[model samples]
Target: VLAQNLVIQSSSEIRKPGDSVKMSCKTSGFTFTDEYIHWIQQVPGKEIKWIGRINPWDGGTVYSSSMKERFTMTTDNSITTAHLQIDRLRGEDSATYYCARDTMSNQGYLPYKNIPKQ
Candidate 1:
């Protein structure tokens, strides 16, 4: 279920192979720095995968094992936004992306909202 009183928004992107795409997720109605922001991806016909998450309070990030090198996560407290930048885009990178607050539960990082892709 979607979280109440929280609003997350992201835009769609288009890019060519070898290019880079930076997606942004903006949040409102909550304390941006107090929550962890996570990025996820869903391929056209596959399951959703966890990309990574950033600790807004300290700017620390933890990415999925395969995505460490080319993915970067950052946050801007001023605008209440989290950013996911993927370098060297490829055909396999074509998918919908999402950003959500990491509620930190036993289940793991779950994205309550989604972002679109390149």
Candidate 2:
């Protein structure tokens, strides 16, 4: 079997509060729609934070309370890509970000597969 990996295209974004930003994640060596895509966050020197997860097949999303109001998750299966957009960003929103896949296997959700910061 081949190894699968998630690739995040954006790395480190600097935006002021109230501004909007979009980041993308792409998958390789696996069925893009077979699992869910999750977005994570980390401050300059803080622990990882769960932003939300998106079902690429149907565009369904579930967000954490911290991001529910200001964040949106989306995917385009045709392009094998997922996206996370932050709207009306807050001062505390400045941080490094990442994307991971919900393998749903014994290993569970795998994070930091692609440590894209934004």
* Number of the top lDDT candidate: 1
Best candidate, TM-score-wise?
Answer: 1
- Which 10 consecutive positions of candidate 2 have the poorest summed lDDT? 108-117
Could you report the Cα RMSD, in angstroms, for every candidate shown?
3.3, 3.9
What is the C-alpha lDDT profile of model 2 across 62-110, one tens digit per residue? 8999779888999888888888888887777776677777764224333
- The clash numbers for all candidates, in the given order, read 1, 1
Cα lDDT of all candidates, in order?
Answer: 0.75, 0.72
Clashing pairs in 1: 98-115
The ten-residue window of minimal lDDT in model 1 covers 106-115
Off by over 4 Å in 2: 1-3, 104-118
**Candidate 1 displacement at residue 55 in angstroms:** 0.4
